[model samples]
Target: MSSSLVVQDLGFAWPDGDRVFDSLSFTVGPGRTGLVGLNGSGKSTLLRLIAGVLRPASGTVHTAGSLGYLRQDLTLDTQMPVDELLGIADTRRALQAIERGETDVAHFTAVGDDWDVDERARAVLDRLGLTHVDLDRRIGQVSGGEAILLGLAAQLVRRPEVLLLDEPTNNLDRAARTRLYEAVAAWPGVLLVVSHDRALLELVDQIAELRDGEIRFFGGGFSDYEAAVEAEQETAERLVRVAEADVRRQRRELIDARTKLDRRVRYGQKMNDTKREPKIVMGNRKRAAQVSAGKHKTMHQEKLEQARERLVEAEEAVREDDTIRVDLPATEVPAGRTVLTVHARLAHVGHQVDLLVRGPERIGLVGANGAGKSTLLRTVTGELAPAEGSVDAAVPLRYLPQRLDLLDDRLTIVENVARVAPDATPNQIRSRLARFLFRGTRADQVAGTLSGGERFRATLAALLLAEPAPQLLLLDEPTNNLDLTSVRQLSQALEAYRGALVVASHDEPFLESIGITRRVTLPT
Candidate 1:
């Protein structure tokens, strides 16, 4: 009656000879556990391994009960009915057939003991805020958020003892997020969610962080986990300081010891030259002094080396949370300066909106799922034409679309940036790219090879470093698919950007982090 998931000495690598995890082991018990890490840290890979979607290069994964996994990207066939997607289509059909008086044993067999399957399905859908959706409705009629919820509902109705969800809230709006949170809060089985959503992470019983090809577990929720990590970092830094001091002290002692040995050798040489003692005695005394000096030098050198080793070990304990650093004075906007003007009628969605952005305004575009936030952004960026009205930018502008498809996959990161900033030399491009944390060979990496977070950084780099320097930036759901660290990095990069920003995102915390000055809500 009990269920658990365990991994033993798991090893996996990509076909490109890049190793992700090596001899990594972890366990998930009953209760919600949040898996967090930077992009490319193999969090998703581990989840897929546990779900049996991927096989490890080495080791075993054992599960005590049935397992269910809800992937982040739910690519449901739009033409499929909701009932079929939920895995109850056959049972529902059999019940209907039995009601028609067929008396077929096969129908009864398919119905099984759960005669109220229809009611259960409806109830589950209602709980997930899909009450308006009927079983016969095709997925194409529903929104992205509805699809994700249906996916979760599919797994929940099965009542599996082990459940896995990967970024389940990526496309969900605030209301859908609340429902998902409640489901996670009440999950009785082992729930491992890989997410960057801070609010969702706060609901977890514990946090499992995958970093540097290893898994580290922390008790309690995200806040508790953060506090523990900070405390540990403080301790690690203290140890590093102590070790550094020891190294310095050992070096000083070694130098002093050498000086003393040299002085003693000089005195012994003087005595030998003066012939202060008999020849045989002098010779024996000289030999003893030389041996003593050698031993002293050896001991001091050994201590110094030991101290250096300790320092290295101590330094290794410290974690590196590198943030981006940039200088963008050209992006600065003065007060009362007109940055953008939006006068558009979204006839496709039956909404008309007018807005003006001035100075260094930070505007947050908020709306329900499928309410045309992305559409509005595309219109503002001139990628789409509204039925009536126009968008005008008074300064240089750049738009970062939701898909991050702004870069050419065949080009290197440096070349991508150079394409946008044609006048800038490769060295200048590399120099600016380093501020985005793409330095050395990383700057030379092809855009296709970068991870989700790295690609976001590269795309942002290309836009911000473009020729003429954008004074107005448009980003559509920039936080989607980004890890928490990448989210922070984006925030940090935008902090340095003095341009007018209009970002469409459902992430409240991230929006607040960048200091939004205005809010634009699309009508539902």
Candidate 2:
């Protein structure tokens, strides 16, 4: 068998908080791998650990080859020109000669070093879709998407044996994402990618799912892996049901035994006292009562142990209901066919960004970095006015910002909902939030410490109970940092929603799930 990256009996916990990974072990060889998990599930941390950026709290991460990591940090020197960053022809030639293990200058220059170095640099740039870029251009003026491509160029130049990418497709257009995926796919090295792009998952050979810091391997592409997960969940649900039934049965038997023991002991005591005939008869009755009492105690102990075991077994079947609930009720649509209008003119930040919504049309505006997608979203939601064009929303609109900042951080989820609809009584708000899975103390729990999905759910709770519900719902990147389950739940909720759904997201799968009816393309 070929050597691969291996982690054995690893356990890690944040010094400030709870443990994220415990006794986690896995192995990956030379192949395409997909790393998937919920937000804050340690996928990014694990990637960093593999890259040697973070030390494991226990155990070991061993690898047989050099590793490369593309983290979220992107820093470019705006003052330095491209040539200075990439080096001159002579420098490039010297670097290449050193890599080839040739020290003699005459030998290195004999085959026309300039031509060779230029060709090599151009080839790297071409592979990374940077052939058209001006080599002398400063990196600062370039867009974020371009910076990502440049980073890929640098990593490819090193030619590492193992590569790890952390959300490499974020803030990128379809063309850029395609380019990034192809580059990683073509590289003859072990690759592990953390991405939400469905297209990228198709290129992977296998997937590793991380939930609650535990990892489970799912062989094959996304489709196969999804089917496997669903099957496993079904099996887990069955185990829970069976264990619960056994616990009830054992409890009943224990209760029956205690009842019988009580009757026998009472009968023996009464008869012994009433007879008062001989010491032998009295002693026999007393001994019989003692035996019955001992038997009862043993049965009680057995029942207690059985109940504890059943609880553990049930937990083994499935973990806690960690699945955050996400459901919302949108307002009714206006009767007319055309519900909104955008007059054509220069928009916010002075651009020609115009849009319109008819009835309950679902529209998605897609654009490259710095193309004013957010600006347009803010304009439509009434947070910002266009520089020239005007947006006409027929009725009250509810907006779910990208960060969901509308929710008050200091209050409980239930409190947040109440404040949104001040006219609603406490009971009405609590009952409405309950439908969104915030019940009892959960509703009382402070919203500031909630997870991203939980915060999103809380925000949805507020939107639903608020008066004059937005006939139009505007969401921005609703699934960017969300898990697959959360995204799926949100998609289902939106699909069932009767109001107009306008979402701004880079996730193709999520967009399709929410039923995007119209699209507006933005220039790169």
Candidate 3:
């Protein structure tokens, strides 16, 4: 049977009654489709609903064939073996039992036909660049990137007709990402992936964007989708300009019409006061003039109203590009100042390095998965002590880890920022938070309640807005799960920072955008 997935009139809402989608509908046939949207746009939710992990409040999801789903956050037992994760442990056990001459009917039933699950699982793993992973090895022994690949391998091993992947490349390094991209490119089944990885999206057959409770399909890859959106925005902006001009013209015409009506009224009053005609004739002329003036005023008013409405409609068509706008002058360092110095052997990679950061230099840390980039950042933050060597910072330092655990979940965004900037008043903290896009009531939202992008913004705001001000900042895979817009926002925020920066990320585009002065690579 051919693979097909369809959704009709889907409606969903959170338990708190916040609606995400209402009467939403879309379809996915055979081929790879990239799902793109801003954070909290219901992409993940829609995937979960289609995967049957979450039930929709209304509407139906239909699948024509078997399905496999890989969630963004994998919850697995650390002690579970690789075979168990691959969902072949039972079959493997049954095969072993049959080999031992334990010809039980139950064992045969468990083994089923085509008893080569082990080899198939191994092949899938190897294809995903996990050739070193042993069937007996535990999940905790592998790196985060390896674990993500393993999750994908598990789905591939199942040979499902339809596969749903949500942010599958979040923790993958460049090499791992390349392998995943190749796999995605080769997928023959119906595949729907929710991701912010540009390279991965580039491999898709089409792009499906979820926005404002609707799905928009764009042909070809990410570049095509981007060009299409750009053209649309350009047209929308042009229409806005046209609408504004129309509104202005209408307003001027309305004013002129009122002025003419006023003049006519004054002239008629003067003529009546002068007794230029008989009383009956003057009365008829006054009523006729009043009626004509009212009609003229009403016609201009309607035109002005129509123009204003068109202006509103045109403005709404333009997308909002809310960005971080702030100045962190406190983070500035003198050209000759040493912001950070480190001489040590990285804990995980055992590489010796002597590094120095001066002034407002930006450094990009580039390496494959398990190459100790994260370890180096942690060591710099003093969270993890180096096995051998000294590290020093001449000014206040801050670190934004990949986990983004800096914020206190129970506190509001305002309170979280205030925690780091204790000297700042509530109003002062809120004012700064607004620049992070958490304005007014949004600033009062609890950190735990924020979406992924919101939480990242709040955490970044807290770190940058700290009382002492960070002169040296360390970031580990900062753009891992950020949507494209959020990534831009992050770059915008960093552009205003005058501090020395050390960022470890696999996203080369992001690194370039943030103005990296140099790059340091750690060997695996």
The C-alpha TM-scores of every prediction are: 0.95, 0.87, 0.90
Question: Could you arrange the candidates by TM-score from highest to lowest?
Answer: 1, 3, 2
lDDT per residue for candidate 2 within 1-524, as digits (tens), equals: 34368888777788897787888898888888999887678898898887888888888988777777788665777866655555553465565676789888764564344545556666877876777877667888777888888777767765678888887877776677778878877878788888776778878989998877778888897778889877877888887787777778777877877788788877777776787568797787678778877877787778767776876776676644544343444466754556667774435345675566777778887766677777777887777767775788776777777667888789888778777688878887777776677777789989889976677777766776677666787887776666665676576567656677677767777788778898887554
Model 2 Cα shift for residue 87 (angstroms): 8.9
Give per-residue CA lDDT, model 1, range 202-260, as digits (tens). Answer: 99999998889998999999989999998999999999999999999999999999999
RMSD of model 2 against the true structure: 3.9
lDDT tens readout by residue for model 3, 238-342: 999999999999999999999988998899899989998899998998899989988998999999999999999999989985778999999988887888899
- After superposition, candidate 3 runs with Cα above 4 Å error: 97-113, 334-337, 345-353, 368-371, 408-435, 438-450
Q: Report the CA-based lDDT of candidate 1 relative to the real structure.
A: 0.91
* lDDT for each candidate structure: 0.91, 0.74, 0.91
For candidate 3, which ten residues in a row score worst on lDDT?
A: 345-354
List candidate 2 segments past 4 Å from native: 1-3, 15-18, 80-121, 276-278, 319-330, 334-336, 348-354
- In model 1, which regions exceed 4 Å deviation? 422-431, 439-442
Q: State the lDDT at 71 in candidate 1.
A: 82
- Estimate the TM-score for candidate 3: 0.90
Cα distance off (Å), candidate 2, residue 115: 7.5
Quality of model 3 by C-alpha lDDT: 0.91
